[model samples]
Target: MKLALGPLLYYWEKQTVETFYQQALTSEADIIYLGETVCSKRRELKTRDWINLAKQLADAKKEVVLSSMALLEAPSEIKILRQICENGLFKVEANDLGAVQILAENKVPFVCGPAINCYNASVIKLLINKGMQRWVMPVELSRDWLIKILAECTQLGIREQFEVELFAHGHIPLAYSARCFTARSENKAKDDCKLCCIKYPVGRPATTQEDQQVFVLNGIQTQSGYCYNLLNDVPSMQGLVDIIRVSPSGTESFTSLQDYRAAVNGTGSPIQLASKECNGFWHKIAGFQTQQ
Candidate 1:
């Protein structure tokens, strides 16, 4: 199995973002995904800058993929989607139908991102027929569900020949909305909200009345409370998934990516505790707690 570093879901300073990827180039991650998939208001890096970064990573022997925004609200967004489709160098990750259409129209071999809701074999085959090079299961999909889908694919004679990637680790991105919670919390309107999400680097953790961390808030996106850590599960799931994706959380200097890569390659020692790690959705359980 290989390690893929997913796109940065949070907004960071331009220099900080660039430096993170530079360090990630030498990390245990084999594939690197570039571009912003979150709110478009966060413009720390332009499209050209992302392209340049992708090129630099590609030069360093890492497979690079450019991700599209999950929500495309305007014509300008479509134009940006067109630009990503027209790039024609690195592979594009389609997060929305608009991106899928653009990539299909341009005949670009692309990846169907985790947001595509591909829970069945027919959907997978449809995308494959449209030139989808790879398809990632949604983060909420569980092990049994995945097995069933793969079985159906086998029955249909389309059993994930291209590649199958999973959101193996990170804060599970639960949902996105038109309303910006960061703005509301800061007493600002959604339209003129002064980029309040920049205040939370790791995102504002949502807790219950008991003060238990339950979710994370990022502008309009809701994410999981416990960061997903599936380091221990990789060995058993060897051939099921081609790449294990490590979504960006804190700074990239911590070497967790390398640790995951080591764990996947069976070169690193195993941890005693899988209880602390979460495989809830992967195991088809309630997501707040672990499932081992």
Candidate 2:
């Protein structure tokens, strides 16, 4: 299976983001997704910069994809989305329906990102007809769900039309909202709030009353508190998935990529799950619970 590095969900400074991708050049990642998929206000790198970065990674013999924002609330966001879709160089991952519409209208072959609520084979078929090149299964879906969907696709003879990507690692992106949760947590309004998300590299952990981490607040995106790991489940993904995606989480991103590479290559034994990691969604349980 191919290894893909998902877009950076957290906000970081320009240099930090640049440095991360620089290190990614030599990492085990076969595919690297660029662009900011969270809040557009986190403009440490603009559209031109992302396209430039994608070019650099593409030139390095790595398949590069430009990811779009999950929640777009302004015309300016649409304008930027158009620019990404029209970049004409790298594939674009459509995180929202608006992006899907734009890419479809332009007849561009695009990736249906995890944020898109594509739950059935029918949607997959429709997207394929609209020029979807790949489908990144929603993070919350289970293995059984995927098997059923792929079966349906096979029955319909559309299974071979597109590749299936699974969000195999990193924190699960649970939801996106119009409100900036990070700004609100800092007692600031969404508009006037300073760029506070950058202070917490991986996002501010939201804990339950019992002092258990339940969610991570990153700008407008809400992610699962525990990292979603599938290193032990690589064998299960053999024929079912074409690519395994690892979301960027900070300094450990490259190490996690290497670990996944080893697991995929059979160069390492099954790694034990950490206390902060879970693979419940893949096992059809509560998303934050690790299946033993």
Candidate 3:
């Protein structure tokens, strides 16, 4: 299976973001996804900067993909999304329907990002018709459901030529909203918010009444309280997933790449070392609940 480093999900200083990608080069991942997947307000890296970083990583012998914003709310955002689609380099991941429309119009090969809501093989077929070269399962889809989708694809005579990717490890990106939770937490309105997300690099953790971490607030993205570590599931994922996504949360999270690498090669135990263990999502249960 291929290992991919997902794009940065939180705000960071320009140099800090650059240093993380440099460190990623030596990690066990084969694919490095560049570009911002969240709020475009975070100007730590511009479009040109992301393209430059993609070039550097590609030069390092890594497959690179440019990812688009998951929640686009403005004309400027759509304008840039168009610019990214026109960027004739490596394949791009379309996180929203707008990106899909742009890429489809150009007949450009692109990846269907997780936020696309491809719940069945029919949706997958529709995307395949639109030149989708890759597909990422929604974070909520379980292994059984994924297998079912693939089976349906076979029965429908739709060749699943598209590579399948999974959110194997990271803080589960549960939802995206127009409301900036991070900004609200900092007592700032979404429109006038000054980069408050940077203050909580890893996101402000929201715990339950029992003091168990349940969610993370990053701008408008709400991620799972527990890191979704799928180390133990790698063996089962071997032939199923073409690429496993390891999200870059903050600097400390890149260690996730090594641990996932060890799990990939069967040398390390990821479930044993996860900051907060969680397998319920794989089991199709409550996402935050843990299981052995």
Write candidate 2's Cα lDDT for 1-292 as tens digits: 8999999998999999999999888888999999989988989999999988888888889999999999899999999999999888889999999988988899999999999999999999999988999999999999999999999999999999999999999888999999999999999999987999989999999998999999999999999999999999998898899999999987688888888888888897876799999999999999999975
Whichever of 2 and 3 has more TM-score, that candidate is: 2
Assess each prediction's global lDDT (C-alpha) against the native. 0.83, 0.92, 0.87
lDDT per residue, candidate 3, 1-292, as tens digits?
7888888888989999899889887877799888888898998899999999989999999999999999988999998899899899988999998899999999899999998889999999999999898999999998888889998988988745788999977888999999999989889999989988999888889888999888999889999888887878888886678888988876666677777777778897545645586877777888876656
Give per-residue lDDT, candidate 1, residue 100: 90
Off by over 4 Å in 2: none
* TM-score against truth, every candidate: 0.95, 0.98, 0.95
Q: Per-prediction count of colliding residue pairs?
A: 0, 0, 1
lDDT of 1 by residue, 89-195 (tens): 99999999888988888888999999877889889989998889788889998878878888888998888466889998788889988888778878899889888
Looking at candidate 2, what is the lDDT of residue 249? 85
RMSD of 1: 1.7
Clashing pairs in 2: none
Candidate 1 wrong stretches, greater than 4 Å? 252-254, 272-277
Looking at model 1, the pairs that clash are none
Residue 102's lDDT within candidate 3 is 96
